[model samples]
Target: MLRSAARSYSTKIRSAVRVPNESYIKDKKVTFDRSFPVQKRTKAWEKDGMDKGEWFKKNYAHVHARQKSERAINGDNDPFDKRSKHYERIKQEGSYKREQFRNHRSEYTRAHPLQGLKPNPLIDYVYGTNSVLSALLAKRREYFVKVSHYGPLNTQIQSLCNKNNIQVEETEKHRLNLLTNYGVHNNIVLECKPLQPPELSHLGVVNSEGSTYDKVEMDYDQSVNTRDKFMTKENKKFPLGIYLDEVVDPHNVGAIIRSAYFLGADFMILSHKNCSPLSPVVSKVSSGTMELLPIFTCAKPLQFFEKSKEEGGWTFVASHLSGSKSKTHLTLNELSGMLNELPVVLVVGNEGNGVRTNLLNRSDFTVEIPSGRNPEEARNTIDSLNVSVATALLINGFAN
Candidate 1:
């Protein structure tokens, strides 16, 4: 009886549904994310803020102001015109002096270095804004500035020259590219006096003690110039000097001068042979420290070292390689034991091959920077430190 009832229920369910095999209906539409309409919405905070049109002006106010200043200098708007308010504001505010900081040099003429050492002009080009500005303020050279016809920089060049008497020439923008020799001149070019290499012999007293020294021959004018320029607060004090033996790279030479001067060395002696000249690059690299450093050339460095020891009581020290096997070898720390010995000369050598073997032999004591690394690592390391770096380390450790 239960089986018959179940069969009747199944028959009823089968009769209620239609079979697919008999027929098919139309296809339904398919929808993808790309087909959906985008919903536009705005955040409550952003709703009251800046519009798209005002965004550029607000965000780039400084850039626009700079451009405006340039236009005034370029004759774009009357505001940027030569005598415009933009230029006048700088004059009133004395903003040009921004580049002229700590400029001790006034209008007084620099005593020309001795006749033979009169620096022959090397290159006419002076790049970088600070360099040209320093050269002008230093009054170290006569500069003829080339600038774009009309702009803020040109206006600055014009204003600086007008007061200081540097000659400024206006040229088309394209000319600066040619003038600076494709270097990054930033649209300004200046031709100033070349770097002057002073003669070594004329630098200071060839002989400290008149009885033991042979005077360097010089006329009245040369004597006056030498006295005026090289004579300084420290020159007359007890002697402390540094001798660079053929450390030729200009960057190194400039950097060493800065380090030597700041570390209280009274003066510097640069070798004429295989040494970098006193160029604008060196001058600028020294952060204008070259201007302050009392530099002298050494035609005979070995003789000068010998004289410093024999005649003057200057201690002759050097930074030679560690374990040099020389009898005078001492670590940098050991130098402190000898500071009671005042007058000293620190000698640093060339980049490739250090102080000549003869120079190393002449040193009163050879100081070495200790190798901090383990023995095995030290073996695979570089043989020598950079000439500039070694000079700085030696200077910092130098006895006052």
Candidate 2:
């Protein structure tokens, strides 16, 4: 039995083992062969009076020459080689900068942030706040809309002064701070002015043809009062509107405004912390959409929504992906068709996390933009689209 088991084991081992493939062995050894082709020196090493390795090491002049020639072929320069002309050019740049700084001899430099930067030609223009206000003011005498989150309309007020070539009494104290915060140098030639007081009865008037209006001041003391100028009228306010729930990206906010304005949507309500539509980047990205819309700022978003409800506004929230029911995924065109024809408020939530539960609970309807494919292979690369892209999709959908 022991002899039979030994024979069986030997047979099993013979069956399991096989000769290695020649090609595999050859390929595997290619790296080692390339580095060291032969085991011993040939006639070339013997003539040099050195072993193969010694000959290769001692005659590195040829290797260096080959490297230099190959570098030239590949358009590469020796970084440490000062004799190279390219090295001198880089050195000159360094020396020139030092000299330039020495000549200036000051800690603060005159370099403007926008000095070398080019704004988008298609989107950006030389229109100052004063210029826009003046143009709008002069074009029609009937209406001029002024919306502000912080202070009163400085840009428009300044623009009006410039158009009329009159200096405003009010110097822009905080305006400079705002511009600096946005990294925009306060290099604009601005003319300041005080806002004309509103009339006792009428706050503003609307024009029929040009759709322009001017301010009508009410009875007030000499004090500069901001409370007299809330843009919303409790009675005449649009029944439905959207509130920005911490949508901080100004570009997204502006795009959303543009979308909302075009969709026959009434207004946008934003928290004080959220970016203003009048911000330079936002205005540029919105492509002048800021002119057509009105936005209101409130202390708290939920409180604002509650007040809106009290004033007869219905809130509709765009729900997030977590077990939230969106009627169906419809393209912009499809969403426009399904939207409520009556007065309504559309709420778009935060970018990463959707609407807060508290806000969602307050919403009359939780709408969502559908995604994924079929019911099985569903996934999204980004949990949601850019706020601006989503806003455009939302607004365009409800446009009809």
Candidate 3:
């Protein structure tokens, strides 16, 4: 009796539910394969070993003809025209603005080819608090164009500018940043003519006349007189000048200059070629010492050395690395002792390569700073000091 009741209940449930036929279900069902077929794609030009331009022309000649015909029909040949089909296609590719900008830039560049290519030779933007203040105090530049500060101007700077009749403008920091090319401006910037150092031949003139060195351009006769005066001075100062040989880094140059000036060196000499320029960055790095220091340029270094040795009896002492095959004739102590006997020009060399072969050979004395580190321990590591540091040490040695 129970089996019969369960069978009747199952029959009623099957009748209540609507079940689809297997054939109908099969007709509605869909299947997708999980695996994707991978194929290698090769460019037609690469496969045919033909030039890309030739292949493009051969395959897309019909497309080009069609485009030309459409362009003619639309009466527009300009690629930059907003209504042109070419411009519309570029817009679809999301390069419409880029193409427009590029077109405008090319036109502008062609119209003014050298607009920003060269910097203003006559002017320089001196920045940083120390650099600006020092420049104002030194009055090295020919004329002060103006002074601009992001915040309240320093009282000293303001007074100096007012006395010199220089214009002062309160400006935003971003403007100062732009003027200094994002250098460490310290909220102040100065506009003025660049400092123009006289040639190396004017060393005697610079030594004799203090601040008016630039004003007196001596001829050969007057230069000789000045040289005699410098050499035969009663006080016997025996000025020691620092010569930079291919020191390309401006920071190193500035540091060396500052060190030389602070250590009582008479003047600074720079090789005309392969030496860093006296840029505003150098001036700032030197903390305005560059403005105060008297600098001279030597166009032909070897010739100048020879002439100075013969005529002025100046000694050339070169700095070299230790543990080298080249013999260092004198140590720093010995050099210091000899400083009083002769007028000396200390030669510091390039960062990577030491003093040039010819200059090294020409030097009367080659001095190397003795290292404190053990030779065996420090052999693998950096053994030489930076050019600027070495220069400072050497200058201090000379001064003492």
Say which candidate scores most in lDDT: 3
Error of 2 at 342 (Å): 3.6
Least lDDT summed over 10 consecutive residues: which range in candidate 2? 194-203
Ranking 1 against 3 by TM-score, winner: 3
TM value for model 3: 0.64
TM-scores, all candidates, are: 0.54, 0.44, 0.64
Q: After superposition, how far is residue 164 of candidate 3 from its true place, in Å?
A: 0.8
Q: Number of the top candidate by TM-score?
A: 3
Candidate 1: Cα lDDT at 157 = 54
The sequence of per-residue lDDT tens digits that candidate 3 reaches over residues 1-400 is 9999999898887465667789767767533542555586988899999999999999998997888788788987653455677666867777867788899898745223123335566879888888999999988778988998987889999999889899999988767777787789999988899887766553322333332122122343354333322222333346678899999999999899888777777678888889999999899889989998878777767877786777667788999775464554777777664554667789999999989999988988788888777768845587789999999998788766
Candidate 2 stretches greater than 4 Å from native = 1-163, 166-240, 274-277, 323-341, 372-380
Which runs of model 1 end up more than 4 angstroms from their true locations? 1-123, 140-160, 170-189, 202-239, 322-327, 336-340
For model 2, the local distance difference test gives 0.50
Candidates sorted on lDDT, descending: 3, 1, 2
* Candidate 1 per-residue lDDT over residues 152-259, each given as its tens digit: 564555677788666666666555555444445655556666655454443233322221212221243352223322222322333457888898898999889888
Error of 2 at 161 (Å): 7.0
Residue-level error in angstroms, candidate 3, position 27: 44
lDDT of 2 by residue, 300-344 (tens): 556645654554334355545554435542244444443333345
